[model samples]
Target: MTRRYVIVGNGPAGVAAAEAIRRHDTAGEIRIVGGEDTGFYSRPGLAYLLTGAIPEESLFSRPASDHDLAGIHRTVGTVREIDPQRHRIVLFDGQAMSYDRLLLAVGARAVRPAVPGIDLDGVVTLDNLDDARRILRLARRAKRACVVGGGITAIELAEGLAANGVETHYLMRGDRYWGSVLDPYESALVEGRLAEEGIRIHRGVELAGVIGRKGRVAAVETRDGSTLACDILAVAIGTQPRLELAHLAGLQTGRGIWADATFQTTDRDIFAAGDAAEVLDPETGKRGIDSLWSAALDHGRAAGEQMCGVGRPYRRPAPFNVTRIGGVTTTLIGAVGTGARDVDLVTLGRGDSNAWREHADAFAVVSDGEANHLRLVLGPDRLVGAVVMGDQALSRPLQHLIRERVDIRWARDRLSRGPIEVRKALQALIERTVPLGAA
Candidate 1:
């Protein structure tokens, strides 16, 4: 029998799964149903689009013709419901489709706070390409903009808006930026860079409510009874997985749809992947949720193989992401937090996985007294995690050391001596231990 495959949410995970399935089962009937108007585009590049760093055409990852060439059928509509027992899905427009296997890669959406006038015309989020376009349109007329959040998305918005000539005011609920991930010195470095770019940083402020005039954002009221003049109010408060469909279809879920090591969900025939899959971590005995693009791509491919009866147990790699934060190219690998916790900071990051916070241990910080910064999380016998900011000469090496858990027991004492000694030791260790073939 020709296997009929139906995948939901045509983003990176869904699209990657379709291609992977096509590679293995040449005759499988693969249909990708998505709600977005456009095809797959680089979600991370949306920041570049806002800042005019890259042309709009550069945002797309897979060309539309690639899917057609691969014999993958694409449909656009909102999925009204999924019937697992019936092996079918119904779209919002009343169209129904059945499949032998179903993959849910619905991804996630940015959360909007429950503030008065939040639904105003000038209030927005940069969740999708459409949201980025809307933000650009608003930036044209926006004189002053206020953004609240403590992660990468919030920084991207503030930077993009400032680049667009809008006087941007970034509101931090805590003392600094990204407190959950970046330490005090790291946060200060990012704050200093953003300040140089003309972004006003307001610390220890929370959005009490948004004030709208004529059905558009005119100002925002802080918790301290201060009203700031604002034409645009952008919110990048964490993201939540689209789990309503999974819940309604009788699938068990916690932070996301629960999935086994093979990416198989509670139901054998249906699978979950990407940001929506709360995959089990056998090592930690906890379910892991990821909002990273690379995680989605890797999981989607492995999930496709599982659907094809390959039974490839998805091997979740150590989390790694390289991004420009506050105008500094930063690379984060594994876990780098120095046991610092911030409830105000959103636990989930837009470009990071919540799993990075799973292992927090002893760490050391090194800097060049400028924008360049490096921090290493140490384990008893190996390197656990790292954060490389500014100069990234050590980024890939750090990732390899942490990911492979290379032994550093010989140099643990020397590492704690000081910054200069630690740098020399890590440079020599990376050169000696890491082979060129290391992934």
Candidate 2:
């Protein structure tokens, strides 16, 4: 009998799992149920679509015909319930499907602010293609737009709206943008660059409520009682993991669906991944949620491989983030200045447009003019995490260093004097993994 593999959700994590399962078991019956109308598309790229940079057809990870070719059955609907004991899923359309193994990748949902006038028109949240389309339509008519949030999505949306000739205001509760990911200095640099582009930023503030005019959002009132008039309001506050199904099935869930090192849920035969799952942080020894695309894909792949009987243990390397704002590219890898004793600081540029660095204990900050690159080194010579802004060329090497734990003491000393020989350093690091004969 052919094994049955049923996956819920069609995001990056779920798609990667399907591929991983196919690699291990060529003849298994694989089925994917997705809530979105489209199959797998780049979640991060949805913002670009709002700006009309990419066509809607190009968003999918694979062509529509590929599903039939791969011998995988895909159902477009919502999964209302999951029965772990019986290994069945109840769909929103009242259909039930039994599975030998089940994977959950339901992802997360946007967090709507709890305030009056939130139900007014011209208020939107960017969570999917439909949401993006609605926002794009609203933005076309919006003269002044206000984005409320402090996360990366808020920053991206604000920048995109501003680029489209919309007067944009970014409101955040923190003193700086991306406070959870970047340090104060790095955050200031990014905030400053956005200001230069004529985007208004309100720091250390909270949205009191949306003020409506003619049944539509006309302005936003902050906690300080200051009102900013805007034609549209975008809420990019954050996301909460979609764990209702898992919770209903009596599976353990923390900030997200609780999974072991191998991506297995409380139920041994069940697994969860992507934005819906939370795993232990190897650095902090505490459970953490990584909502990045790379982490989600890796988690899905690992879970699928394990389900197919591969004995690969999930060894999460580090959390990393990369984004481009107003033509400035930034990458963040490993850990930042969180849970540190002392930090060694370095700055490559000056003012709100310079690269900033904060190194303490095992962490290092490397930035160059409006682009902030952060690298967190953990335990001896291991590179644990890094964040780079403005230059992606630096990310590849930085990622390699953090992943392989390359000892850059020699390179670090020479970097300040002049351009350090990256090729030589990489070659030296490769020697550790590759044999001399292969080299």
Candidate 3:
């Protein structure tokens, strides 16, 4: 008898899992369930779609015929509940499906702030293709738009709105943008670029509420007691993993659904992936939920292979993400988030107030700035992480160094100076480490 597999969610993780299952377990019955009625669409492409850079049909990552050709059964409906004991899942529409193995790739949902008037008609979020379409339509006629958030999503939305000739206002409660990933200097660099693009950025101001006129947003009221007129309000605050189903099923969860490196939940037959799954680090015992597109694809492939009787711990390559904010390209790689407790940081120009030298050994800092800036997080033995803004030519080399954990101790003094010196130092290290042809 052929094994039956039911995968929930049709985002990157779900679709990748389906494709992987078809590749590895040819005889298995594969079924993918998604709440959306459409085929696989690229969530990231929604920004381009809003800017009119890409057509609606181009939003789809995979055509409907791809699913048909793969012999994968597609169903549309929300999975209301999972009966783990009976190995069955019930849809919100009251349909039941049984599976030998189940994978939850439910992804995440955009977080709407708890301010009043958030439910106003013109207040929207870009999560799905539908949201993109709505925003595109609104942008064409919008005179003024306000985007609230600090992450990549907010930047993308603000840029899109500005591209469509909408007067855009970016509001951030923090003094610096993306303080979670970038330091003050780096944030300033990005903020400068955004301002140059004619975006009005309001820093250190909280979003008090939205003011609606006839059920449509008329203006945004800031906690500072100032009102800014705007017709469209886009919130890209962040996203929270959709873990209600897993929680309801009694699955162990932390920030996300807890899963081992093998993508196995507490129950051996049930697995989780995408932003919903938290993959634990064996050495540090820390669970990391990488919300990047690459992480979802990697997790799905690994989970699918493991489910097909090939058990191998998923090895995450160094996390990497690239984005264009204010026409300046920024690339971040490895554990660049400021949240890590064990990580140390060092900066070139700033006076040494870093706590790492007294307690821990490894750290990172903004090394140098010219037409571009380079920040490096150094471990005891290798390059741990990096942030690059402008002159992205260094991105590839830095990525290899961080991901491959190349030794850079030989050029310690030179590396401490900043970008230009660090580049030279890295070149020296690369010559010794990588083969001539490879370099």
**True lDDT of residue 237, candidate 3:** 70
- Best lDDT goes to which candidate? 1
* CA lDDT for candidate 3: 0.79
What TM-score, computed on C-alpha atoms, does each candidate reach? 0.97, 0.85, 0.91
Q: Model 1 — TM-score against the truth?
A: 0.97
Whole-model lDDT, candidate 2? 0.72
Q: lDDT of each structure?
A: 0.86, 0.72, 0.79
Runs of candidate 2 exceeding 4 Å displacement: 281-285, 338-360, 363-383, 408-439
How does residue 81 of candidate 1 score in lDDT? 88
Best by TM-score: 1
In candidate 2, what are the lDDT values of residues 211-288, reduced to their tens digit? 999999999998899999998898876678888988888999987899887788899888898888887555556666
Residue 120 in model 1: shift from native, Å?
A: 1.5
Show the colliding residue pairs in model 1: none
